[model samples]
Target chain A: MSAADLSRCSLNSATVKHASLTELVDAAAAAGLGAVGLWRHQVQEAGAEQAARAVAGAGLRVSSLCRGGFLTAADEAGIAAALEDNRRAIVEAATVGTRELIFVVGGLPAVSAPGQGPRPDAGPGDRDLVAARARVADRIADLVPFAAEHGVRIVLEALHPMFAADRAVISTLGQALDLAEPFPAETVGVVVDTYHVWWDPQLREQIARAGREGRLASYQICDWILPLAAEPLNSRGHVGDGYVDFAAISAWVSGAGYTGDVETEIFNEEIWADEPVATARTVGERYARYVRPYL
Target chain B: MSAADLSRCSLNSATVKHASLTELVDAAAAAGLGAVGLWRHQVQEAGAEQAARAVAGAGLRVSSLCRGGFLTAADEAGIAAALEDNRRAIVEAATVGTRELIFVVGGLPAVSAPGQGPRPDAGPGDRDLVAARARVADRIADLVPFAAEHGVRIVLEALHPMFAADRAVISTLGQALDLAEPFPAETVGVVVDTYHVWWDPQLREQIARAGREGRLASYQICDWILPLAAEPLNSRGHVGDGYVDFAAISAWVSGAGYTGDVETEIFNEEIWADEPVATARTVGERYARYVRPYL
Candidate 1:
């Protein structure tokens, strides 16, 4: 497939970990891909301005920024630090020329995340999910003005419920939208990631509702694989390698009137071990075969 | 706390895997737990009639049965076998003196579950979650008459979304309620298992809804522990050990007017390794400190 054939598909930077922002940009441009999605860490490592320049130099679009939300902090200092980091993230996202800054809104307090241990600075243990969720809202409200001023949409990504205990409080597109609805569409949005949400019963209606609300900031694709016990964070597969029905999901995205770039943000260890350019090419090929046709 | 304090705390048989039904019943009665929940496998191993006799002999009430639903079959033979097995499960539940028979509706097709391999009898492969869920509803419908005839309520247990692929497709208390509402309250009901549902955003409302509709069949508890990657099926901890705010959750269950036995269905390896009587005593102690107060 030509670059035009891969027009709507975007390779998320985390998918190819060894590559710097410049290398990812060049590889995406050379691999017949039209755009690349960047992670905040990668852009910061290369310096956001330099990363922006690299993408511009390669004539490729920056689809969206990888992440910018752990706003479930309960302590005052932790909350202050989280807001500061998010403000910096918004500035970096603006520098990278992507309006969407994804937020993995944090999970239940004190619970340890896989590999990444407990947040050292969280308040005296909070297990009240309701209170933690309310805190997430208040913190987002604090950041909305800064995000809007920087021309960035705070995009909420509802991870699979496995992460609900320690990674993300927002565990469904519906919940993400509930949080998003309180803010303007340009200031707050939600991501439709297939791997994270393929199991949700309300996904289709929620996708349409997201588009209708003009909060569909990003459309992401990745297959939900087997041997799920391997590791929650790295169990994703190529589009057709798992149980996700990409055709039906892509059609839902298209029906939602979302013409935005469909990004692949897989976290599998095996895919990360492969060559960057080859992985990018395979991502596009899988998108064309399993997703694009339905869209 | 005395045995009277543990009036509502029921120890699920899965927590004491090595013990035979007679031993478990004797231990529960000795441990001052008013009831002991039985699993179909244990009941079958001891003979359902013999299990019922042991429970009666020990003056211990049988709480809900462990499970009887993997009814996501797409083929005729598979569907027929599931119904047959469920009928036997109903008979076993009746024989064991429990009105409730729990169902863990199976997950997406061909995926390998933790420890348990893929079901060789499952159809070619069903990836459409919507279709699989619809199939679950259909199979449950097929089981209702038999269950009702046997004076058993077909109970649905919503697993955490982590198990949405290979263990259980029903992933929320609300989804379970939705499935349960279609049948008469006596014919179909839902379980409120804290470990599987503590993360849901709509849990409080759904709990109330389940109460209002008279579809709340079972109340089970087990702490949602840390180091979640240990194993999905065996990661449960003792009450108050993990991030579950049992006080608040028990308050909700009480507010919903649930007067039934609050069972503990923990599956932790460490807990199972302990002597059965000791484990039951610890379970009661934890329930008294963390859960009984709220109730």
Candidate 2:
């Protein structure tokens, strides 16, 4: 087994969120990396068309567009608004020259005021998770044509079940595939993020099934930390910093015929504080050590 | 659709951790509840024989034993020690006259030192969750015969996936049933705890399967609260106080022919601060209002 080549390494912008779109692009090229994953917020900050021109101008490939799905809204008006925003996201992904538009299908819609973040002390309401999930499926179906016409794919990312309440209702790759089964694989596929699916008992079988069905849209990597951050949303660790078995998981991912860019996507506050260039270098080195060998 | 009969209500001692075994038994009987679930710690505190006598004398049935399985140790010594501890728990349950010995099967063995709890800053070690799960299956097989001989059933409890690292590896009812399938239903069964299994996408199907197999050993209820406490283990709320839809879930339990005791097993700091008698009365009222009608 030789060392994993840097050709497949792509730095997700969220990994070094402090970096501007230009800084992320220049950093990846400066670090001798092959590609970069862009987030919509950062892209929107630079104007989507301008961000796409900058990446293309630098000769860097956009591995994926950060997000486009929050289809589970509390009301009919909210659902219509989400669909309108997602349509714009499809056009943005196409402009950025990335077919993969990752969808973090949202959880149960909040009943609170629009600007107020999730109230920690709020009691549970009549949020039907199953119904929220059904809305996601229907909304995705509604968007598939627009996404396909724009030469983009709807990439469904199943977050860890802990986030099932406020982040994403799709808690497993199997569930994601089940939702995607009725649609064309190229139009609606699933994201296999190790950070989310590593704890799953049926991971290997489901990853294999995802591959067999041609629904493996993306492969994101990050480690799972313990005594999770005060807000677990930022608990993702740098590669090799937490408890995920990268070697084993990567072997399964590679075995499933996935030859796409392996994006390092950490969301830790501690990692976000480090210098972007230094973090990218460290992430590359760790990926080579922990994940590359198996690949 | 009249009010649910209180004849089947059981107060799990942990729900009122501040209460002594005698107090719990007396409170449940005084509340006109038909049964009480005992934890080994409480039973050991009162002496199993004494606890048994107190419950019997109070005319209350021992609904089920709190737990007995932490079988996923990393070393032979740890495995042997866990087996010995579980063996004692079995005898304790039998001595207290309960046929169901509930098992909260332990998670990946810790590499940390004795008395040192899970380190928030610890790096990922070589803990293989799959292998640890295999060890749990093997250990449970080793304990099944002893459990059968003693006229007690090994009840597998699938905890929420958040506890997969330091607590329990069985993260879903489906996974628990898979582990229990190799053994006889009479000797091995699965617990249906709303707090643990409520997030599951396959809840209805799995609960039905457990019923069809005659393996629904215990049906415990508690609400899932949000802004989970710093230590998530104590985040359980009283019924109707959190997100779980008790009417929907309890109907499934009842349709499956689960005529056993409905144990209210809450573990919240707020709930624990209340007087035991008052807590019991509140729980009974909530159970009747939220879950009993469905059952």
* Model 2 residue B211 distance off true place after TM-score fit, in angstroms: 0.7
Q: How high is the CA lDDT of each candidate model? A: 0.85, 0.84
- Each model's DockQ score: 0.51, 0.38
Model 2: per-residue Cα lDDT over B21-47, one tens digit each: 878887887777778999998889889
Q: Candidate 2, residues A179-285: lDDT per residue as tens digits?
A: 99999999998999988888788889999999999989888999876777777778888877666778788988899989898899988899889988888787778
Candidate 1 regions off by >4 Å?
A112-125, B112-125
Model 2 residue A61 CA deviation (Å) reads 1.9
Could you give the CAPRI-style class of model 1? medium
iRMSD values, candidates in order: 3.0, 3.8
Which candidate comes out best when scored by lDDT? Answer: 1
